[model samples]
Target: MAEIRVDKLHKAFGDFVAVRESDFTVRDGDFFCLLGPSGCGKTTTMRMIAGLELPTSGRILLDGEDVTFRRASHRDIAFVFQLFALYPHMNVRANIAFPLKAQGMPRGEIRTRVEEVARILRIAPLLDLPVSGLSSGDRQRVALGRAIVRQPKAFMMDEPLGALDAEFRELMCGELRALHDRLRATTVYVTHDQLEAMSMADTIAIMNEGVIEQVGTPRTVYEQPASLFVADFVGSPAMNFIPFRAALAEGAAEVRIDDVAVPVPPLREAVEDSELVLGVRPEHIELTDPNEAAPLRARVFGVEYMGTTQIVTLNPAGGGTLKARVSSELAVRAGDNVGLHLRPERLSVFRKRDGRALKSRLHEVPHG
Candidate 1:
């Protein structure tokens, strides 16, 4: 296992900048994920660390040894590409031994290393089978074995499971997590899939454009998103951002979104004439009785059943669209006026200008 530190990393192609000055560190034996949409420089960032791409300017350190100018082969890091690149002519065993062979290990040592890695990846049973006939899942396991045979300091996975179907992707996610747990390998997984990062990584770096929008554990990034982009990109169905004016009353604050009037989490100091955003997660909204007090009303527009829970889309009774995941038996069809109860405990308040969190007075309340 190794610690990876990327300091002031930057990448540029002629005139177009692919990555800007960025800094972050991945602890030894941690599963860290770099997440973002296409062309967000995530691949470029990963490549720089692997010595596959030279940073325009910056330093990459492996366990405190500067390796920015080191060759990819000299770095001794494993890379698993999005597509499996197994040699069709070789069997799984041979493929797994290829890395060892390239490193000039003794024949007997190569055989032992290959067998051990195959066992770790649970692909020993198919070692004698030709690589050409393996399923995608099996091929991926073989690819993993091939990478592990060399005993690299770290593993870099670039959407390695992107080729698998949904079911296989989900299954591989679990397998990958378990494998990492067992090996305690320092891993850097790059993906555009937020759900995968949220589920598998110990820490996630949410990148947008060319810079890291936020970096933290999955729970922190999801629960206390540093910015609006992080908030919108990390959650499923995404968090709702209702624009409202913050009104200071006698001792309370009110947020008016559409025709709905809801009490905003009180601010520590009065924020007069400021535009505030009332952000709530879909999972926090509940479908409730029409006569419920202080209920925000919305008409149902769509419903998606996910076996365990149903996603309910509502036409904001005020004027926007809101999505809430409810129980399958909640039973609300399109055009049904449903009341929603916002979970204040999970609600986030953001300033419209810079999307920074507003000061909350929740802790200053008179009683617990």
Candidate 2:
């Protein structure tokens, strides 16, 4: 396996930029993910790293050796596409053995490696079957098997399970992560799915437009997003933003919402903006009775039952609608008045000007 380093990598098509001057490293044997929405340049970034696309500027290093301009075939990197790129004319065994055969390995060696990959993928029984006859999941396994058989320096997967059904996609995610752990292979996976990145990546790079927004562990990004785009993009229900105007000094412990003082984590930086945004995840909000003298009050608008938990959507007295994940047993109904108690330490404050998060104690702690 190889440690991949991308330094000031940039890509452009005429006047439009696909990837800006991005810099991030994929440590040897790490499952790093480039996560973002469609046309956010994640797949483009992965392509550049895999040598499938040339960077307009900057360098790519594999284990300290520069390979920025290397051809895709010369990079010793295996790429698995979203749609399984298999030869319908060949059987699964042949597809798996193709790479080794192209390298002129002995027939016996090819057979051993092919069988080994088949067993690892749990597709040994399907090895002799025609590629066109296999199921989507099996074909995806075959695609993965083909990549694994190469024993390359690293693996680049561009939404390899994107073609499967939701249930199968979830199943493949676990399988793929397990395969990475077993092989200890350096892998870079590209996906727009937050669940996939959160569940699988050792480190995640959140991209927006052509720029890299933030890079951190799944927990770090989810809890302490560097920018508003990241905070909004990473979570399922997404973080709720409550807008207000405040002139807060560093070390201040509270802010006024609708003339009511609400406790917040002490601001590590001063905010002089006429407009600011307070972000809180649904799960961090506690709903209380409106008569209880809580800091914030809201009227329940809707309740979405989600098995063990229900998402309570409410209209805050201050302004804007926010959702709170509460126990399903709580008797919350539409038009019910409720007081919202936001967890102080878990709140994130952002500047509406540049959409950047204010440095707080939550972000100051070194993430493990």
Candidate 3:
């Protein structure tokens, strides 16, 4: 229901910086995700937005109003924690009505709000039960109900599904996204799990070491990572990096890796660094006969079978190990020598000096 903005937001605990000059926006009615590894400052950033923690420097704006120094209670933002923070002494109905009651709403109005939120969350049947006796999943629903009943300007969730088992977490992911769609509320979700972020977020801000690495739609972040850190952190198998030394002029079409001329997407700018890294996703690699002339060659070290595909581990002659996703139907075994062909259009070139991705044709166009 609001647009959230952070400008040069910085946080520090004495000498150690928890967040550094971060900047981003959560458009109104959008499901925005702050994604990263542990201690990457996502939680701190969210807290600042919710008015739970004061930023050491910079500004936080909610719906065009500065709330940087406002108290959490004054922000009109609801926060859901990873552990379902519900009152064990209270029944589900009472728990969900707590916020309205605290606001001194009429008793009848509180009852009406509680019932509406319970119905929306599909938790109406458990309204009379004690929260302590509920299942983890049910308790989580109650937590969500409590937050939803507030009708706040925005909602902030910090890995609300992290307490559930794998199966329940997956199931809740769908339920949560659907709830957002129904409410169309401005939601800021923080999580370290890439799968959750990729599956649920309308836009994702990938963070690391207190810095925002890249912010884009899920497909854009995955297909055209802005930096090396983003390329490795946003994928399951992660992008494979083939390290080599080369100096090239602008518009160069190819580079030599192990004396093999591997075609690459033309560079938009010259790369003066001799140390460069070639990044390719596992699914883009194709295995060919070793005897055939190809850009690169490797020996098959192992195969991991999935239902429709297999992961072929290879030891490239140019050094370093690589994995290829291939059809499981293809016959391949350990110790089999194979030539490797990378899809040229999908290649990413990065400078090792700063771990920054090089500007090239591959990144010039926006990914669908």
lDDT of each: 0.86, 0.92, 0.93
Q: Per-residue CA lDDT of candidate 2, range 1-368, in tens? A: 99999999999999999999999999999999999989989999999988889999999998889999989998999999999999999999999999999999999999999999999999999988999989999999999999999999999999998999999999999999999999999999999999999999999999999899999999999999999999999897999998889999999888887787777778899977568888999999999976787767899999999999999999987678898999999988999998888988888888999999988887876535
Q: Write the per-residue lDDT of candidate 1 for residues 1-368, one digit (tens) a residue.
A: 89999999999999988899989999999999999999999999999999999999999999889999999988989999889988999999999898878878899888888888888888888999998999999999998888878778999999999999999999999999999999899999999999899999999998988989888889888877767888899988999988787654434565666656676566565566778788888988988876565457788899899888899988875688888988887777887777788876667777788887665654234222
Cα misplacement distance, residue 59 of candidate 3 (Å): 0.7
| Per-residue lDDT of 337 in model 1 | 76
Instruction: Provide the lDDT at 170 for model 2.
Output: 94
User: For residue 67, what is the lDDT in candidate 3?
Assistant: 94
Candidate 3 per-residue C-alpha lDDT over 1-368 given as tens digits, one digit per residue, 9 for 90 to 100: 79999999999999999999999999999999999999999999999999889999999999999999999999999999999989999999999999888899999899988999889988999999999999899999999998999999999999999999999999999999999999999999999999999999999999999999999999889999989999999886889999999998999989888788889889999977579999999999999976888667899999999989999999998678998999999889999989889998899999998888888898777644
lDDT of 1: 0.86
lDDT of 2: 0.92
Off by over 4 Å in 1: 247-272, 359-368
